[model samples]
Target: MSVTPQASGAASERTGLRVTYDGVVYPAEEIARGAAYELFSADEATGFEWAPRPGTTWPWRRFVHVTEVTEVQGGNEPAEEPEAPLLVPLHRNRSWSSVHQLSQQPAAADDPTLAAVRGSATVRRGTRMVKVLTGRQLAGYVRGWLPHGFCYREHDIAHLRTPAGLAVLRGDGTSGREGTDIGYALRWRAADPGDFDAPVGETYRGLLALPPRDRLGPPVLGTGFVPSSAQLIPEFVTRDFADLPMPANASLLAYTAEGTEVVLYTYQAEQRGWLRMVGPQWRHLLAAVPGLSPDQEYVPTGDVPRSTQLVGSYAGGEYEAVADLPGGFRVLAMTRAARFPVDSVARRLRYARWRGVPCLVLREEAGWLRLRLCRPDPDAVVDTGAQCHERGVYETWAPAPEVTDDQVVDLSYLV
Candidate 1:
């Protein structure tokens, strides 16, 4: 049987997807009956597409294949042995077939952490130092379904060796806050130890060594895609932790009380590049660290200036910001071209359920929208989308008189 990587604009045409199922890559026609799967669009040169489905709005199910993949040596030759999956580096993009292939393989044969995850009989969660030794181990695995690329960076490679195995801990000087909507941090284990002996960047380059395509599309645009497997690691770890079943009397505060006392100047730290926690979370920190106190030093932050093009008129005026919110943040509109009120806007900005938690969308600066969980900060200026929903209102940032819901083009072309 013949198998090949999908072609440009093939999805829109009669040619269906190149789907990977049960360790095999099959054309759309050859996909086994009753197979459960998702779709991936070809690289930029080939535009994104959606199939006829049962909804007025698009479901965020399809993903675009961003990695460089092509036919290998003896392109048309018969298979000698099932081809070993190509392992892409952490924080990089991969083709759907590559991701599917990598997911099936064992992360590491001798890794204890993975064994714990699988509920292996031999693995044990012993009394280990909590601070010095992190419960989380860096394991290797490919991104399952989400679109990945922004997290890639150049940094010194660090490895942590536990009773489990050698873990490749990703280290970068860049701030985590900078990037497109963070999909999730990926933890991977090396399939081969020799992969570690080589420089990490060199290894990544080797894995991503496919020749460049003559026709490539621009990078994905903001708000065009959502990550399906973004929180896999956190969810998996949380489930495993819950499954272990700690005792009813288990007190996290008491548990840490037995450990050596550790003091932290949280407020001072926040002033010097650390994050500030509020309320019960602060108590949780106090439980973990001995001498920590609430914002006793309550250092106030000055308002960061943001200029918006606000207009006042008779039938209410046209108001728009010079910048639009970052992609992925959903918003609710309170008013259109009305005199911006200070008190009423605060009342309108209440937390609503987002991904099962309360959230408000605030466009802080150009190319960045913050989905804050707690109440909006005192200085926050919330956007009502000018009477639009989710990301639709962002279209008004264009020079046209006003952008409607139908006018929002597929910005994924930039992606």
Candidate 2:
């Protein structure tokens, strides 16, 4: 019973993925089975793994996240106790395995103000705030899953106990747009090393501190293959207020809300910063209850620059900025390309059922064909053997390509 981490090229240009195999390689069926139980919500990101039928395409799989797992230690020896969940060893694989995660703070998770950026689609009438929180947490988690390196920072929010919640705001930062994506500002309960000895608390200290660094590919090209666990349980306390003791064993808490986020805009402040997760979601976002500034300041996020490349039809229409996903997929945000109208692209995506999901249809790049898809699918079964002519027709930046469905591609060397 040996476990190892392996990563291969993905189906898209922007997807991050990694594969774990025991003594024997895991069949696609097993991978598909895990999807069913994979905990995708950030607040519920325990990383145990989900069980779903094998997907023809990647949905909420392949990203970066942490799992609080408890396995009996002193292996090769008799089992002394049962498995438990402990906060430790964040998974940095680009592989879809990251889709499976557990939650540390369920309360914040249930709030809708924090749902995913796509909450509008999943959110239904009569939805509670908790469901919304889950959606928002997913957005930031996916962003950290970017194929390249992501700089992780730390922040301190003074006054853990605030008359106006500024105390909690000290340690954390706001995420993305409020009407769209909401985020939370939480601090983890930093535990003592001795605490991990018990099975209940997350084992993030000592020998059990990490989930095997091998799981993270390489520090550079494989950003997902970075630190598996904190060298020590990092303690986070509130900032900017009168004296207040922080929560022990606290590290993160996510919630969503419908208001402007509090940002410590000083560039020097961002220099040695903590994680700032902003996205369109319901969970992990907190609503501006009667307490914190109720009138709601309508400060618009300044214009994000357009991209060098435009995706989809050329007939330019309503478009967002060209967005960059974790893997390698980058396209103007749901906007229209030059010739193709954004409306038609929307219609096609609705027809294709791939509105939010990223994909790579072959397009020309420096004369050679380049695949541009959303977060690349780890262990993607590309059909290169099939002639290039068989590939599907897709619209892309500068170079337009013919879309051919289900072409066999050969990438053994890259694999």
Candidate 3:
């Protein structure tokens, strides 16, 4: 819809000026010396409308969560200091053919040159990390799963907007399923670059050596990118394959085959829940999500244990904090006014051995500690009695007293 920049008046001073597009109000900021306005919103507000701007491309309305007014600039900003190889999008007409050819390439796990190039890629604290999810994985994250395993930087793949365009980047090995019209993804700001490691070097050689049956997704291409013959999108894994705490405003999204981007849900870290944003028309997307009711407006996740958390000290007391980011980290409070920037913040995680298996302590109950296997294999799952929640993720509970060598550690990644 045509976005009429609100006049610079009293309303601009209060909530800043906003632009309405497709019935949603977005807080707009003047960027590039006022040549274009960047519209961004963390909330899922609606009820406003605007006429479509003439000559707008298909991606215009698809920029649901963030977009620049000029339409030429996608939400992802180019790196201030380029380190990785430049990536250019293929012609829309040739994208599918190119992706198919690239997906067929043999894994380049032993390519030293490619590995070094990929290893050189870096993630800044505020870099947007993206995990393309299957319908089942999307459901898991909506429930309580934190960001873990393999992911990519949003800056590298912003041009791939549609389901077909993103097929090459799928983490699941199996492809070419029919009737798949929508693609799902989770995007969030990186709380710390140290939490990520390129799946290269001797550390990940074992992952590359694993037989096909033992692994879930595509093989780890030491090239630090997806299994593509041409795409240079660098891939990363959480350090020690541990879960990174979900930051505030993390978004669960859906992209139609036609390239319409839908904001399915935006995480509310304070409430430890997801605020559903998908309208009635898109409710069918949730049909594939196991046990999740499409009609439910907000899903509470506080009760579900997590592997890592953001904690902060404020007013002489330690409290759960949310990474609001750019604005900085703050203590998560019930009311908006109560959320204040904390005096100190750190990531709280505990590692322990249960039944001779390395596990990350999720949470502690009366006498039991919920633990997730750091690396899930068939034997580990059986030994720990861990239930398979999703591909490559397993969790179970153990008696707190029986869990040996329990140690709580706090990490600070603030710059």
- Across 1-415, the per-residue lDDT of candidate 1 in tens digits comes to 1111232124313544455433334333211111112333232212223433232122112321212222111122222222122223343454444443333333331233322322211101111101111111100111011111112110110111121111111112121222211111222211111111111122122212222221111111121111123211100111000011111111111112111112222212112112232344333433322233345333222232211111112224332211011111111223343323211110112122333323333323454433332211111112322221111111112211221221111111110
Q: What TM-score should be assigned to candidate 2? A: 0.19
Worst 10 residues of 2 by lDDT: 236-245
Candidate 3 per-residue lDDT over residues 1-415, each given as its tens digit: 1112232222233545565555555554433223234344443334212323333211122222222232332233533443243332446564544533443343545544444445556787777788888887788888898998788877667656667667777766645263368888999988888888876667655555545665555666545667765455677888767788899999998876544467889998877899999888788877866788999999988577766888898889998888886568888898979898899888888999998888888788899998877765566767888864433446799999889878888888673
Residue 90 miss distance in model 2 (angstroms) = 21
Error of 3 at 44 (Å): 38
**Tens digits of per-residue lDDT for model 2, 146-260:** 1111111121112111123221122112222233333333222211111111111121111122122212221111111112222111121111100111111112233212112
Report lDDT (CA) for all predictions: 0.21, 0.21, 0.67
Candidate 3 collision pairs: 2-51, 23-48
Backbone clashes in candidate 3 total 2
Q: Which candidate model has the greater TM-score, 2 or 3?
A: 3
- Lowest lDDT 10-residue stretch of candidate 1: 138-147
Candidate 2 Cα misplacement greater than 4 A, ranges: 1-224, 229-299, 304-415
